[model samples]
Target: MSRGFKKFSKNSYKFFLLIYKTYKLTKKFHEFDRIFKKLYNLLNFVVFSVFLGVGYGKYCIK
Candidate 1:
């Protein structure tokens, strides 16, 4: 192979590696996002319930 073609091939391989890594990282972030959303929703529900119970208890006492 000519020197120019060899250099081009090497650069191409590096670019492919970069693209593959980006795809893997994106997938990982998506999974993390789903988990985070689930936890956030659960926490929100707990907080809402606490507030609601407190409000009802105070109303009943008065």
Candidate 2:
């Protein structure tokens, strides 16, 4: 009975550790995703502004 209790405790400790590690990884991924989204938006805005400027230049020249 004592042996079984020791094994159970060990397994529970490992399970909790696994859960904690997974939570930390997910948190990091969320942070990376937020930063990536911001960078993507900034890139899109830059591209859009460049195209708008080119189009306006063409209109003015014509």
Q: Pick by lDDT: which candidate is best?
A: 2
TM-score of each candidate structure, all chains considered together: 0.52, 0.52
Could you give candidate 1's per-residue lDDT for residues 1-62 as a string of tens digits? 34765577578657755755675577667775666557656855775687678778888988
TM-score of 1: 0.52
- Candidate 2: segments with Cα more than 4 A from true spot: 1-28
| Candidate 1 all-Cα RMSD | 22.9
Candidate models: Cα lDDT each: 0.66, 0.66
What clash pairs does model 1 have?
Answer: none
Tell me which residue pairs clash in candidate 2.
Answer: none
lDDT of 2 at 33: 62
Q: For every model in order, what is the number of clashing pairs? A: 0, 0
> By summed lDDT, which 10 consecutive residues of candidate 2 come out lowest?
1-10
lDDT of 2 at 60: 98
